[model samples]
Target chain A: MFENLLTWLDSPQTLQAIVVTGSLLLFGIGFYGLLAYTRIIKILISLSIMESALFVFFLGLASDPHKTAPILGDLFKNFEKMNDPVPQAAILTAIVISLATMSLGISFAIEYYKRTGKNDIAQMDALGEKR
Target chain B: MTGFITLFTLLSMSVVALFSLRQSNLTQSVVLFSGVGLGSVVLFFIFNAPDVALTEAVIGSGITAVVLLIGIRHMHKEPEIEEVMMENRRGIRRIAIALLVLLTLLLLGKTLLGALSVETSNAGQALLEHAMQAGAANAVTSVVTYFRGFDTLGEVAVLFLAATGVGLLLTVEKGEDAIYIEPNFILRIGSGFLFPLILLFGLYIIVHGHLSPGGGFQGGVVIAAAFLLLFLTRRRFGLSHKIVTILESGAGMAYVLLGLTGLWLMGLFLGNFLPHPAEKIGMLVSGGIIPIIYILIGIKVGSEISYVVEKLIKRSHDV
Candidate 1:
C-alpha cells in the first residue's frame, strides 16, 4: 500500500490532478465571494482571483514532468522535451489584459463612490430603480 | 521530488485564496491576495515557464496589490454591509448556493479527469520547431513577439484603453491639493538609493528578453514598480504628463511603423523582415526585429503603468 502511494505521488498525472483540483477550488472560492460580497471592490478582487485560477489551470495542464523550460542553451539544447510555449505566451497576454481590466474596474468603483458616496453594490440604484 | 513540492505549493495557494476572500479588512485581503500571487510564481517556475513566473511575480504580486491598496485608500471607509447581508440571507438560499457550487465543481472535475486521458495536440511541438526561425533562444519570447505578435499588439491596445479610462475617470479637479504623508528618513533615503538599481535591473531584463526568461511585460512592470517606490517616498513629486504621454505614444507609433515595415518587406505583418540566421539563436543581437519590438513594448508598458500608478497615488492635478 505504501509503495502504491509512492508510485502515485511520483507520477506527472498526480501533479496535474492536484493543480486542477486546487485551481478549481480557488475558482469556486472566488465565485462564492462574488455572490456573497456586497462591496464593489471585493467583487472585483474575487473576479481577479477567478482569472488567476484559470491562468494557473492553463499553464499547469500544459506542462510535463520530463521537460525543461523552452529556452535553448549550452546545458539544454533544442526543444525536444520543453514545456509548451504557446500556453505561456497566451497566459502572459491574459495576465496583462486582466491587470488592465482590474484596474479599470477599480477606477470605475472609485468614481462611483466619489460621485454617489456609496461603495456597496446593493446601494447602486442610479437608473430609476427604487433602493 | 518536484511534484511533491508543486503539490504543496498548490495546496498552500488555495488556502491563501480562501483566506484572502474571507478577510474583513480590504487592505489585509489585498496583502493575502499578493500571497496567492507568490504561490503562482513558484508553480510557474516549477512548471518550466519562467517568463510567466516573472510576469506574475512583478505584475500580479507587486503592481496589482499596490493598485488595489491605493484603490482602497482612495475610498472612505464604509460600514460592513456584507455582514448585514450575511445575517439577512435565508438559510435555504445559502444552502442552495453551497450545494450548487459543489455540484458544479464535481462536474468540472469529472470532465477534467476524462479530458486528461486524451492526447494533447502537437501544435506546440510544431511551433517549437519553428521557434528557431525567429532567432530567439527563448521559445516563449519568439512565440509572443513573432509568432503571435498581432495578438500582443491588441493586448497593448487594451492596456492603453484601460489607462485612458482610468485617466478620464480619476482626473483631479483644479485647485484640489493632493493629500501627502511625509515619509520617514529611512524610507526616503532607501528608496532613493534603490531606484536607480531597480531601473537598471528592469532594463537588463528587457534587453536580455530573447535570451532569458523575462521580456517586455515583466520588465516593464518592474520599471513601474521602481516608480511606485519613488512615489511612496516623495511628497510633491509628479511625473510630467507631457513627457510620459510623448514616451508612451511615440513607442506605440514606433511599434506600428515597425510592423508596417515588416508588411512592406515581407508579405506578412510583423514578420521577421531582417536576416536572423539560425547560428545567431542564443546571441543578444539576434532575433531580427523581435528584440527591437520587445524594447518598444517595454518602453510603452513601463511609461503607461507608471502613469497609472501616479494618477492613482497622487490623484494628479493635470488632466
Candidate 2:
C-alpha cells in the first residue's frame, strides 16, 4: 500500500494537482486574512500573500515534465526541449510591478497611520459617517 | 523529487504566511514576510528560472525586509495589538467570508487545471525558435530587454515614480540630531567585510547577465541590499540624494537613448541595431545592445532602490 501510494505521488499529473491545490489554499488563506484583519498593514500583507499565491499558480500552470529552461546553455540547445518562456517573462514583469504597488501601498498606510493614529479599516469610516 | 521539494516549500511558505499574520509585532511580521520571500526563491529555482530566483532572493527577501524594518523603526511606537470582544467576533461573518473564499479558490483551481493542457501559442513557438538570432543565451533576458524592452522601460519608470512618491510622502527635514543605534562590534566589522564582496557579486551578476541566470533587476537589488547593510551598521554614512537622483535619471536616459539609437539605425525601436556577433552565443559581448541596456537597467534600478531605502531609513525618524 505504501509503495502504491509512493507511485501515485510520483506521477507528474499528481504533482501538478498538488501544486494547483496548494496555490489555491494559499489564496484562500490570504483572502481569509484580508477579511479577518482590520489593520491596514495586515491587509497589505494579505494582499502581498495573494499576489504570491497567484504567482505560484501561474508558474506551476506552465510547468512541464520533460522540458528544461529556455536558456541556450552548454548542455541544453534544442528549442523543442525548452519550457515556455512567455509565462516566465510575464511573471518577471509582474513581480517588479507588484513590488512597486506594495511599496506605494505601504507608503500610503504609513501616512494614514501618522495622520489618524489608527490602522484599523473598520474604524476608518470617515466617509460613511459623513454620508 | 522536485515535486516533493516544491510541496514541502509551498507548505512551509503557507505556514510562515499564517504565522506572520498572527503576529501582532511589526518587526516579527516583516521577518516572517522575508521568510515567505526566501521560500518563493526556492520555488523559482525549482521552476528553472534562476533570474526570477535571484530577484526574489535579493529584492523580495533582502532589501524589502530592511526597508520595512526601517519603516517600523521610524514609527516610534510598537504596533497596536487590538483586543477583540467576544460579541465583535461575528461567527456569521466568519462563515460567510470563509465560504466565499472557498468558492473563489475552487473556481480558480479548476480554471488553472483546465489551462494546464493548453499547448504553447504559435508566437511563443516562433520566439523559442528565433531567440538565438538576438544573440542572447538567456531567452528570458532577450524577451525582457529586447522583445518587451518597452515594457521594461515603463517598469523602470514605475520604480522611479515609486521612489519619488515614497520621498514625497516620507519627506522631513533631515534630522541632524537623529539617534543612531550604535551597532555591535561584530555586526560593524562583519558588514564592513561583506560589503565589498556583495557589491562585486552584484556587478558580476549584472555583467554576466546574458550568459547566466541574473540580470539588471536582480543585480541592482543585490547591490542595494549591500548598501542597506552598510547603512544599517554605519548610521553616519550618508547617501547623497543628488548623486542618487543623477545616477537614476542618467541611466534611465541612457536606456531610452539606446532604444532610440536602435530605432535610428535598424528602423525599429529597441531593435538589435548595435553591431554584435549573433553567431557567437554565450560570449559576454554576443548579445547586440542587450548587455549595454541591462547594464543601464542595473544602474537605474540599483540607485532607485537604494535611494528609496535611504529615504525610508532617514525620514522615518521624523514621523
Candidate 3:
C-alpha cells in the first residue's frame, strides 16, 4: 500500500496535485496564523502568503518539461523551443499589483498603531467608530 | 526540463510548507512564506518568465518580508497561554465565499483548464516569424509595445490608477515632514554609490529592453528602487516637489504627444516612427518608436512610484 501510494505521488499526473495540495496547506497555515497570531503584521504576512500560494498554483500548471524559457538565444531560436510567455506577462502585472497592495496594507498598519497604540486585532475592536 | 523541475519543486515546497506550518511562530511563518516565494520564483523560471521571476524575488521576498515584520512589531503576538480569541469571526462570510467560489470553479474549471491547453502557438509563432518587422527582437516586448499598443496604453493607465489608489488610501489631510530617519553611516555611504549605479542600470535596461527581457515596467521598478534608497537614506533628500511634478506632467504629456503625432507620421496611433526594413533584427535604432515609448513609460512609472512612497511617508509625520 505504501509503495503504491509513493508511486502514485511520484507520477506526472500528481505533479499538479502536489502543487495544489501544497498551496492549500499554505493557505491553511496562513489562515491559522491569522487566527492564532495577534500580531497585526503576522496577520498581514499570512495574507501575503495566501496570495503567493495562489500565484504558485496558477504558474506551476503552465510549466512543461518539454519547453524551454521563452527567451531565445542562439541555441533555441526555433518555435519548438519555448514555453508560454502569456502567463509570465500576466504574473508580472500581478506581482506589481500585489506590491502596491502590501505597501498600502503596511501604511494602514502603521497608522492604526499610531492612533490606538495597539496592533493586536482583538485589542483594536473599538466599534465601527474612530475615537 | 520545465515539467520535471516544476513537479519536483512542487513536491519539495509541500514538504517545506508542512514543516513551516508546524512551527507556529510568526518568524517561522515568514521563513515558510519565503520558501513559498522561492518555489514560485522557480515556477516562474520554469514557465519561462524572467520578468516575473525578477519581480517575485523583490516583492515576494524583500518587500513583503519587510512589511510583515513592520506589522508584527506593532501587533501583539499571541502568547502560548492566551486563549485564542477569534474576534468577530467571519465564518458565515467565509462559508458564503467558499460556496460561491466552489460553484464557480466547478462550472468554469474545465473551461479555464482548457484555456491553458489552448496554445497561442500560432500567435506567438506569427510574432516570432515577423519579429524583425515588428521592430523589437524581444517578442514579448514587441507584443506589449507594438502588436498591442492600445493595451499597453491602458496598462500605463492602470499603474497610474494603482498609484492614485495608494495615494487616496494612505495620504494624510496635510503634508508633514518626512519621517526624520537620520541615515545610518552604511546606508549613507551605500546610497551614494548605489543610487547612481541603480539609475545608470535602469536607463540601460529601458534603452536596451527591445533586444533584452527588461522593459518599461521592470526598468521602472529599478528606477523606483533608486529613489526608494534615497528616500531611506536622506531625511531631507529634499526632492524639489516642483521638479518632480514637472517631470510627471511632462511624461504624461509626452505619451499623449507621441500618440497624436503618430497620426501624422505613421497614419496610425503610436506607430514606430522609424520604419524597420523587413527582416532586420537587433539594431539599436531598429525598434524605432517602441524603445522611445518604453523609455518614456519607464520614467513615468518610476516618478509616480517615488512620489507615492514619499507622499505616504511624508503624510504620516506631524508637521
Specify the highest-DockQ model's number.
Answer: 1
State the C-alpha lDDT per candidate: 0.83, 0.76, 0.65
**For residue B46, what is the lDDT in candidate 1?**
86
For model 1, the docking class works out as medium
- By TM-score: ranked, best first: 1, 2, 3
Q: Give the per-prediction TM-score of chain B.
A: 0.92, 0.89, 0.76
Candidate 3 CAPRI level: acceptable
For residues A40-97, could you state the per-residue lDDT of candidate 1 as single tens digits? 7788888988888898888878888678899999997677778789999999989988
In candidate 3, which residue pairs get closer than 3 Å at backbone N, Cα or C atoms, i.e. clash? A39-B76, A41-B71, A41-B72, A64-B3, A65-B1, A65-B3
User: Against the true two-chain complex, what DockQ does each candidate achieve?
Assistant: 0.60, 0.45, 0.31
Could you give the candidate ranking by DockQ, starting with the highest? 1, 2, 3
Per-residue lDDT over B1-319 for candidate 2, one digit per residue giving the tens place of the 0 to 100 score: 6777778898999899989888877678889988888888898888877777777777677766665665565555543556222345467448956786677567547644665543333446678887878888898888889988998899889888998898788765766324367899999999999999999999999998888888898888889889888777887786876788788889998899889988998898998986766568888788888999999999998888787777666664332
Against the true structure, whose lDDT is highest?
A: 1
- Model 3 chain B worst lDDT run, 10 consecutive residues: B114-123
lDDT of 3 at A90: 63
Q: In model 1, how large is the Cα lDDT of residue A124?
A: 79
What lDDT, from 0 to 1, does candidate 2 have? 0.76
Poorest stretch of ten by lDDT in candidate 2 chain B: B78-87
